[model samples]
Target chain A: MSRIHHLPLHVEFGDCDPAGIVWFPNFFRWFDAGSRRFFVACGVPTWKELEKTTGIIGTPLVDTQARFVRPASYGDEIVVETSIPEWRTKSFVMKHRILRGEELLCECNEVRVFAQRTGADPHAIRAVPIPEDIRALCG
Target chain B: MSRIHHLPLHVEFGDCDPAGIVWFPNFFRWFDAGSRRFFVACGVPTWKELEKTTGIIGTPLVDTQARFVRPASYGDEIVVETSIPEWRTKSFVMKHRILRGEELLCECNEVRVFAQRTGADPHAIRAVPIPEDIRALCG
Candidate 1:
């Protein structure tokens, strides 16, 4: 069974909009944090460490979908539950659920691939095959 | 015919991740900007104005999907093209395409609804029917 990870977040005033609700993009930021937390919970190496050992820069999203069920405001303490449901040859699907106590605030599903820097362009990234060792760690 | 709007943005250094690429979540921030700009380009009143005149606070997204094609970094300037492709009784679909010159960086489709405050809860919002004048303006 794949291990699921949970990351708790404290929403600050900067995370809210003029409407006094959390800005939508901030959820994505938390989701990305959840992704990293999932890997960490699985005892995976940090992306920076992997760059030296495996040439893997990081996992970057190719596609993503999100649904907002309710609005949250500043000072809200939320938890993001993250898990990797499927692993492909070069990609994986990561899912996140943001919640406040028992209330689900938002949910997201993302398709992401392990990436490597291409050539000398520091910004250019190319997808690489899923490393077996990393998969074993996550599993 | 529906009007399309474009919002230009400069990528700041803080918007980049440790990898020096634009963090994926920042695209959603630009998309929200494009959504507001679309209504502005259609000559609709600002959300603050509508709150008093029409009881509409703003358009809040219910669902969203995005595809990231190319990565962008700090110092890059991008433009987001926004348009409404479909309008329902209580919701509409907002589309945004982020581009660097002719290169498409990311694209998003969002299902959003006009919302207003509910009851005594300041942060609670409920969807309202599509306003006729607003529809006419967008169309």
Candidate 2:
């Protein structure tokens, strides 16, 4: 079974727009943070450290779909529940459900790939096959 | 003819990650801004103004899908091109293409609805039908 992770966050004033609701992109940010936390809980190293140890830089998102279920305001405490439901040769699917108290605020699914820096360009990135050790760590 | 609106932005240091690439969520933020700009360019009133004239509060996203094509970094100047390609009675599709020079960074399509404050709860919201005046303004 894949491990799940939960990241709790306190929304701040800057996280909201003039509408007094949390800006939508902040949900994506929380989801991304939840994703990273999931990996860390699985004993995975930071992308910076992994780059030197395994040449695996980071998981870059290729596609994402999200739905807004409810609106959240500043000062609301939210939790992002994240899990990896599927894994492929080079990519994986991450599912995130954001909740406030008993209410589900938003949800999203992301398709991301294990990537490696290509050439010497700092910005050049390419996907690499899933490493056996990493998969085992997550499982 | 359906008009397109372009909103230009400069990537800031806070917008990037340790990897020196733009965090994906920032793209959503820019797209949201572009969505607002699209209406502004078409002479639509602000949500605050419309709240008094009509019960409509704001355009809230129901669903969104995005594809990341390229990575951008701080100091990069980018533009989000937004247009409404489809309109329904209550919701419409907002499409955005984020570009840096000739390079496409990301693209997204969002389904958003005109919303109104529901009940006395400040965060409670409900979708409203597309207003004729607003639709005409967009056109």
Best by TM-score: 1
- TM-score on alpha carbons, each prediction: 0.97, 0.95
- In model 1, the clashing pairs are none
Model 1 segments more than 4 A misplaced: none
Query: What lDDT score goes with residue A3 in model 1?
Result: 75
The i-RMS of candidate 2 is 1.2
The per-model DockQ list reads 0.80, 0.75
TM-score result, candidate 2: 0.95
lDDT of 1 by residue, B50-123 (tens): 98887788998899999999999889989999999999999999999999999999999999999999865646
lDDT of 2 by residue, A1-139 (tens): 6787988899999998777788899899899999999999999899989989877778889999999989998889989999999999989999999999899999999999998878665568888999888899999
Relative to the real complex, the DockQ score for model 2 comes to: 0.75
Fraction of native Cα contacts reproduced by each candidate = 0.81, 0.72
Q: Residue A45 deviation, candidate 1, in Å?
A: 1.4
The candidate scoring highest on lDDT is 1
Residue A30, candidate 2: how far off, in angstroms?
A: 0.3
